[model samples]
Target: MGEGNWARVKIILRSPASRLKGVCADARFSGPVGRPAVAPVLCINGPEDKLFRSQSADITLSSEKERIKKMLSEGSICEMNLEVELFALQDSNAKLVAALHEANANVEQWKKQLSAYQEETDRLRDQVADLETHGGHGPSDLLKDELTQSLEELESLLKAKDEEIHILQSKKSEYHELERDRGEAIHRLQELEMRNMDLERRVQNAEQTLASSLEERDRAENEVHRVIDILDVKIFDLNDLRQSLAKLIDK
Candidate 1:
């Protein structure tokens, strides 16, 4: 049987055996329970040299008149204070033992809770890493929209450049036919030079457009890095919280 239940039995059954039954020592129940159980401690007033000849721990207070106390002469109701003191010691011991058992159980429960918290924290960290990988270093909606806008702009510029390249090739073909009509004339030579100048200008514009597109790509990369840093900090916070809770549980 549980020690708590055993203690309760002793308290309930002690009434028929002694002047007063043993009391429950539960501090939590003390408001409803008035007194601690009174018990007898055998202090042999005999010679110390013979102390170990016999050691008796059990005592039974049979009735108001014929009760037995270990340390007291059998029929002597010597001191009220001594009787009260003995009972208090027994009650204190019972209460303390019960408290220790409760504390041990509580510690085990705390350990389980701490373990669960650590597992959850680890899972959240893994999720954060996955998000950083797929979310382009940033998981926020604003960053996502910015990246999308940049991609659209780059695609538009690329399509426009493709059309310009096509137009340039057609112009070059037309210029080649014009060259065929030339007859060692200065007008034809000047026209050819103007066509060459147009081609060079197109090349320069294409380079400038490519440079702007590269800048957009770099900005997008920076935003992604910034978001990754944010996730790292949040992960650290989660770990710290888990540790703190674990420490509390240990205590």
Candidate 2:
């Protein structure tokens, strides 16, 4: 089918033609008694002559048969080898396809997890914003104002002396309690901030993993295409070889 293959067929075809030409030339000049024979039938003069010619013809036919057998045997071996190689390539292609499917499944799973993480991150961000807005002027600010007013009252009460000492002590206890609550609220806010940072880091890692899996899938697909193309060319070559052998046999 290809120009190169056709050329090879032509070369193979010439061998048999050349062999036939040699046989013809031998019949014309190398006849019995060293005399040139115009035709094979004219060369025979007796039963012995006929016997010699028959024997020579039989030898030539036998040799040609053997040569043809040898060529066919070699071609069969080559075909077998090609078949084995084709089977191996097909197996490898199947494995690659399986791996590609597994990679696709993994990619899909990662996508789902990434989506979930993103939704959770968004929710956490919204909560952080709400806490910042409400808590900025909520319990902590109110407690600071109350503590400041209590300190002013205590300073003024200190000048009034012994009667109000007990009252001053009670206000001090309430101020310590409010300070502790503010510390706890700040601690909770810091923990939330830390949790948000960890989630962001996890989201970034998931994205990178997804990207890597996609690239690997692409590479696997390319390899499968390359193997398929190779198999096509090999099949073509095998067909061409079969056609050439058929023509040789016909000749």
Candidate 3:
């Protein structure tokens, strides 16, 4: 038996033994109601009464023992199951945390790429303005080609950003599922709930920052397109001027 069980059994045994001793003491102290008692001596009940009471106490004690054993067994099983579940939850939480970290890292990397793209777009815009002020001379075609390439690259980056957003959305869904599973054990594990809430808050913050970054990228892409359109118009006008000059020289 376990220490706890042994302690309980000792209490059970003590109760009956103490009660029996008390009965003997009471019988010895009080004889017939008015008669004076002699020296304190052992008080004995009838053999049949003693036997019957002993048998009854034994039966009660045996039943209690069995009940306690059964409860202990059931409790052990429950504890084992809870341990298994706790292990599983810990493993899953670790994986989720690792994935969340990876996602955050990816977002940070994309943010850096977007910043670089924004800088490139600003430089291209300055180049286009310079070309316009100079009447679109000197390697106009090469600059136009470069601008087209940058535009394509920006569009591809935008597509990649959209894909990253989709991935984040999926991760969010997984988090929701994890939250629901954790909810089942929430009452039993307040500490896990607190940690989960903190993780959720972090994910929300990441999502907001990613959203803002996406907006900025969109604005930069629009500005680039506008600059490209202006360059195209300027190039067409320069082309017409070249054709008109060539016709005058031929005449």
When 2 and 3 are scored with TM-score, the better candidate is 3
> Highest lDDT: which candidate?
3
Candidate 3 Cα deviation (angstroms), residue 136: 4.0
Clashes, model 1: 4
Alpha carbon deviation, residue 91, candidate 1 (Å): 99
> What TM-score would candidate 3 get against the native?
0.49
The lDDT of model 3 is 0.62
Residue lDDT tens for model 1, 1-251: 56776665455445553212112122112333222243222233332213222111111112211221222332122334334544555565456556556655755665575566556555655655677998777456754565556556556655765675576566556545444433233344455455556545555555555455455545554555565555445444444443443354354
Candidate RMSDs in order: 54.5, 34.3, 50.8
- Relative to the true structure, how large is the alpha-carbon lDDT of every model? 0.46, 0.53, 0.62
Name the candidate, 1 or 2, with the larger TM-score value.
Answer: 2
The better candidate by TM-score, 1 or 3, is 3
Better of 1 and 2 by lDDT: 2
TM-score, candidate 1, is 0.26
From the highest lDDT down, the ranking of the candidates is 3, 2, 1
Q: How far is candidate 2 from the true structure (C-alpha RMSD, Å)?
A: 34.3
lDDT for each residue of candidate 3 in 131-211, tens digit (9 for 90 to 100): 788886654787889887988998899898999889888987887787677666654555444544555555555555545
- As a whole number from 0 to 100, the lDDT of residue 247 in candidate 3 is 50
